[model samples]
Target: MEYSWIRLLVLVACLFPALVECRVRHYKFNVVLKNTTKLCSSKPIVTVNGKFPGPTLYAREDDTVLVKVVNHVKYNVSVHW
Candidate 1:
């Protein structure tokens, strides 16, 4: 009974840091503007899915990643490897 309690306490202590290191993130909204017709030809640069740099990523050191990106924009979106 006493040995079981000690083992449980050790397990909890080891797992606490792994849980706390994960962070939560939120982004603000954005709007795009453009002009058309016979006059000054103006174009607006907009964010993909209302995000400039896009989503926040979290990972530990030396972790393998396999992710797919889906573009919702009418134009091309570039990501450097």
Candidate 2:
């Protein structure tokens, strides 16, 4: 009985990450704002695609992270981890 319980525990531990969700999605807006000091400047703001706060995603730990970022603005954008 003890051995069986231990085996069960090990199985549960191995599957825990799979059972849980941990994936996340984030979006931002790239804008060029003119500042008085710089004469003209541009900055990137956090936005979910186009909406505020963007979108919410969930995934399990150790899971592969796959994200697709599309730029709607005219300026070139780059993202770094």
Candidate 3:
């Protein structure tokens, strides 16, 4: 009897759909070196799309963001998110 109630609850939950608007946002980050003295004092520093601090990604609630990062610099970079 208890197992039947649990099964019914599971079936109902599975059949119920989420009532939320979901959207996919796409952004591309191009890693390159640019001449700037903001952070790095000496030579050119690695930046995203020629920006010093990179770009800001903004999305609404329940939004899925997809980022594509392309490295054009000679050195490998590991960006901490």
The prediction achieving the highest TM-score against the true structure is 3
User: Under the 3 Å rule for N, CA and C atoms, how many clashes does model 2 have?
Assistant: 9
The C-alpha stretches of model 2 lying farther than 4 A from their native spots are 1-46, 77-81
After best superposition, candidate 3 residue 79: deviation in angstroms?
Answer: 1.6
Instruction: Give all TM-scores, in the order shown.
Output: 0.36, 0.37, 0.65
Per-residue alpha-carbon lDDT of model 2 for 15-68, expressed as tens digits? 785566655544343333232224366555544344444555555566565666
Best-fitting candidate, scored by lDDT: 3
List model 3 lDDT by residue over 1-81, tens digit each: 999999998888788746446789999999999876655576888999888788889998889999999999998998777
lDDT of 2 at 59: 51
RMSD of each: 8.8, 7.1, 7.7
| Model 1 CA deviation exceeding 4 Å by range | 1-45
lDDT of candidate model 1 versus the reference? 0.54
Please, what are the lDDT tens digits per residue for candidate 1 over residues 4-74?
99999889989785655443333332333233234565556555345555545555554444445565556
Ranking by lDDT: 3, 2, 1
Against the reference, the lDDT scores of all candidates come to 0.54, 0.56, 0.87
- What residue pairs clash in candidate 1, if any at all? none
